[model samples]
Target: DQTSKTSYDLVVIGARWTGAVGEYWRSKTTYEVIKTIQPPVLVAIGEREQLKRFLVCTGGKEFIEQAVQFTGRLAAAVNASVTLLHVMAEPPAVYADMVRLEENVDQLLESKSELGTNLRRQKRELERLRVSADVRLRHGIVIDQVFEEAREGDYDLIVTGTSQARGLLRHYIMGDLTRSILNRAIVPVLVARAGPAKPGRTLWKAIKGLVRTR
Candidate 1:
């Protein structure tokens, strides 16, 4: 048997899913592939030739550029409706923190001068591309909220992109979020990483100190 295999430069599957969104991909997963084939998780809902609705998940600035450009280009190409979703998670705590977090989330979502400015900028960029889009803000568990919205609406694909340049803290925390969404999402999750897949092991440590130390 040919034991050696190369990474998938781009793998687009059909709409038909045997089980969960990533189950098919997961079942076929290999340690070799998983290590090197890490890319942004862009989840496609159903098997269709053209996308009708696309969901762009944004919050962190690291991935926003890739997220916006990719979403805009794809939406304009297919003339799909874009829903820019930013899921704000309540701070982890009890009564006081919960209430405060809720209030803060409310403020950001309600105030035109807050998150609204960012959303407007996003809208303007898409408008320049001639791809009309609407902004949506939701509060709760980030992954849960995203899934709930995906189910309620007719989103054809879910676009989530971010990069943290291999940090210790980020690896344990934010890494889980991305992995969880990819594993659990009923829709397609696109996690965009900018680079080519390599032939060696995936997690090759290159950084000597904390990124913030500099």
Candidate 2:
């Protein structure tokens, strides 16, 4: 009943794998905690430093906007650079050539597609907060593509979002995907949520107020 009863502004956990035998159970427990939590989670794996470059992952899913909004506010705080990344899964061989998954952000924006439109909306949202972000596209398995991009881009932080469905349904939906990213990511991963869980509270309003006052 914790997921149904409690909420938080943020849930932060440290990550340090010793490569021991017991690390398996430790990882499993961490994943469970992440899936059940109702707010954003930050899995910190290394030393804390100034976050200069942020890689925000967007799949046009539930919390993409929230993730971008939060990132924009945080970036504004330190005057950091932001990059919006959208990853496409490898296509079937039959349609591989037609998909042209290699198309970059600029090329995609020129076309009329849902993904392009979503990216534009997210970019505009960042612009509203006075943060200009670079848009990038990749093709492969979601997690793999993200890892590759993180290494190639040398980003300081990785921001991703998932559905906030609770209990059993949540486990089947995005638990693995979210957990996997946190487990393997070399940089800190900010798992953004739709909003606060309880009524009479709005995370966006609080963030906006902070940004304005800054």
Number of the top TM-score candidate: 2
Cα deviation of 49, candidate 2, in Å = 2.8
CA-RMSD of model 1: 8.4
Candidate 1: regions farther than 4 A off? 1-50, 60-63, 91-114, 164-174, 194-214
Q: For every model shown, what is its TM-score relative to the native structure?
A: 0.61, 0.73
Task: List candidate 2 segments past 4 Å from native.
Answer: 1-8, 17-29, 92-97, 166-173, 195-214
Model 2 agreement with the true structure over 1-214: per-residue lDDT tens digits: 5556776667777777566643322356556666666667777765548788989988754346777888888888879889988778778889866567446567676656767776888888888888868898887888888889999988889987766554455431345666677767767888776532233458998899899998
- Estimate every model's Cα lDDT from 0 to 1: 0.59, 0.73
Which consecutive 10 residues in model 1 have the weakest lDDT in total?
194-203
Model 1: residue 178 alpha-carbon error in angstroms: 2.4
Q: Residue 39 in model 1: shift from native, Å?
A: 6.8
User: In candidate 1, what are the lDDT values of residues 1-214, reduced to their tens digit?
Assistant: 1223655434343233666434535443421233334433344534545568878777724336555766787789878888888877665466666455434643544556545566667767888899988777677888898888888886877776545445443221135556666666666656654321123443434343445467
